[model samples]
Target: MLTSFYKMHGLGNDFVILDERMGALPLTPDRIAALAHRRRGIGCDQLVTLHAPTVQGADVLVRFFNPDGSEAGACGNASRCVADLVWRCSGNATPVLQTRAGVLPTSRTPDGLITVDMGAPRTHWQDVPLAMAMDTLHLPLPGDPAAASMGNPHATFFVSDFGMVAQGHALEHDPIFPERANIGFARMDGPHHMRLKVHERGAGMTEACGSGACAAVVNAVRRGLAARTCAVELDGGTLRIVWSEQTDHVLMTGSATTAFEGTVDLAAYPS
Candidate 1:
């Protein structure tokens, strides 16, 4: 079947979005991976699928799939992109999205940026699901990285420079993180700003990673290296991340842009 899709991006972390709200589409993991292959298919950092909401107060169900075809618990940038799409279609500035992680509330800021309340950050080793218990604030890793969960596991390495970012691939598969982890290399520019580069699990290095920014900020705060609210500069662009002290929720604000819209025959791709 030919499926209609939207080519969208939050910063430069692009996605191929398929709306399955009206009906279920024949989308297997391999098919999704095929669709995300840069040389062989539509090519995107990730594939997002929208389905009918199954929970109360949610406008839609958002699912994120990595290029490797693994399902991710949450994706901050993708959420903003999906929220923007839903808001434009329903004419609602605020839209709630349900995902594997939980319900997330999103809204459009006065400046035309989309903000997603990414809920509270998780710090427990159990939450990160480490192979064993350890202090999340100062992991035993070489760079003394820290770990946090924004639905999915993340390990942030605060560096004086970006030279150590090359270790991301090895750290991601370390036995300590049983479920694997997104590795973020953060360089503090100041208490209120930082530069970031992430080797996302399954998706490799991307131009931007919203959840990584959130996790990096949360981890930085825990280490007393950054303030609760900070600006994160990624390769694609910058994102304003506010770790609200009152709610303990992380708010990610950024632009979601549509590159184009197109249709593809699922049958033509590997299933």
Candidate 2:
């Protein structure tokens, strides 16, 4: 069997979008890892699949499998790419996206950017699902960490500096998080902007991470460090996240580009 997919990028975080409807293609951990291999595979931070909706209200379901075959509940930049795929497939200008988090409304903005309603921030101790309960805002990580959740669990920490902690022996094999989270070290340059360097679990260091940016903004706003609406500058580019005034919905606006489209051998990831 052959699996047809579209290679797309939201900023520099790229993905391989598999349209299973193109055929019956199943994925496994080994296959996912191989597909994400920079040299031997399609090379992406994550792989997305468009599947039939599991819920009644959703127009389509968006699912993302990280390079390590772990599922992520929310990914802002990927959401934009998924929206464009759904909109193009359905020929609808406005598409309703549903994920484990909840309903996400998406559309193209005036500036030709994809905008996603990322829903509310989940910052409670239990919601973040830390090993034990603590004041998530002031929780002591083995390092400077802001334990929070955009959808799936994430722990964002601001390092005293980026050089000392650029993903070497400092983070890997650590026991702070049971499922080991995607680590982002940030430096706040101003009240409204910050720069991020990441050591994503499974996907090591990458150019950008949409969900990581969302988590960073949510945590910053909760701590009163940054405004509700601010820009997160990642290694790849910048993302705009707004913890909305009236709805508390985190709206992420960014660009999505189609890299190329082709078919991959399903023999690689057979069910």
Candidate 3:
């Protein structure tokens, strides 16, 4: 049977949402890409689906796929959108959504913004899943491989300028990472702030990436270039990331807005 969905965005990090409490639709990468297409589809940066918990005793499961069809561990803006939608559907004040990174807690604020506690950031080499064993904070991108977790995996590189690189270079062809990774560049401004040019896996070059911004800060700080908490400016906008020495997890707070919402004709999507 065909499925129903809605569209939302958090600081230009958009998502196509499906509240599958009863599991009506099977979400796949190709389908996600189809729905995210502006020319032939609804168009979004990410696709979010919420369903009953996969593991017993856990809260609802929130799954996400980038426009490229790859599933991500967590998404800050998308998580907020998911929390708002779940709360609206279930009438629960505080909702939990399980992800690969583990259980994430989200609450609907009076201002209508969804606030999520993104468990923690895994900064070590093993936790960040770097193939080589070494210090994750300072380890240079093997090639295009700059990876860190804002409860998700991201890889970035330092470049003199981003205007020279093509948009969305693939990981498959890059040698630094055996498994393809999200590629981007970091341009430094000072001891506390910098800018990012991201070629997001699955989504290509988005206006901004929330988790990516956090990863960029950690990457710079670990490398002894930037401060823990600073303003990260991206192509789309800016996000403030706080990485406390006391708490390993990165805290990302941003704005989310409900753009228009409508259901797509499933038949119009690709198989």
Whose TM-score is greatest here? 1
Per-residue lDDT of model 1, residues 1-271, tens digit only = 8889999998899999999999998899999999999999999999999999999999999999999899999999999999999987889889999999889999999989999999999999999879998999989989999999999999999888889877878899999999999999999999999999999999889999999999999999999999998999999999999999899999999999999999999999877
Check candidate 1 and list the clashing pairs: none
lDDT of 2 by residue, 78-111 (tens): 8899888877777875788888778788988888
RMSD of each: 0.7, 2.0, 3.0
Q: Compute each candidate's TM-score over C-alphas.
A: 0.99, 0.92, 0.84
Q: How much lDDT does each candidate structure score? A: 0.94, 0.78, 0.71
TM for candidate 1 is 0.99
Off by over 4 Å in 2: 167-173, 269-271
Please give the lDDT score at residue 160 for candidate 1.
89
Q: What is the TM-score of candidate 2?
A: 0.92
The alpha-carbon deviation from the true structure for residue 22 of candidate 3, after best TM-score superposition, in angstroms, is 2.3
Worst 10 residues of 1 by lDDT: 160-169
TM-score of 3: 0.84
Runs of candidate 3 with Cα error greater than 4 angstroms are 55-59, 87-93, 107-114, 134-146, 167-173
Which residue pairs show backbone clashes in model 2? none
Candidate number with the higher TM-score (1 or 3): 1
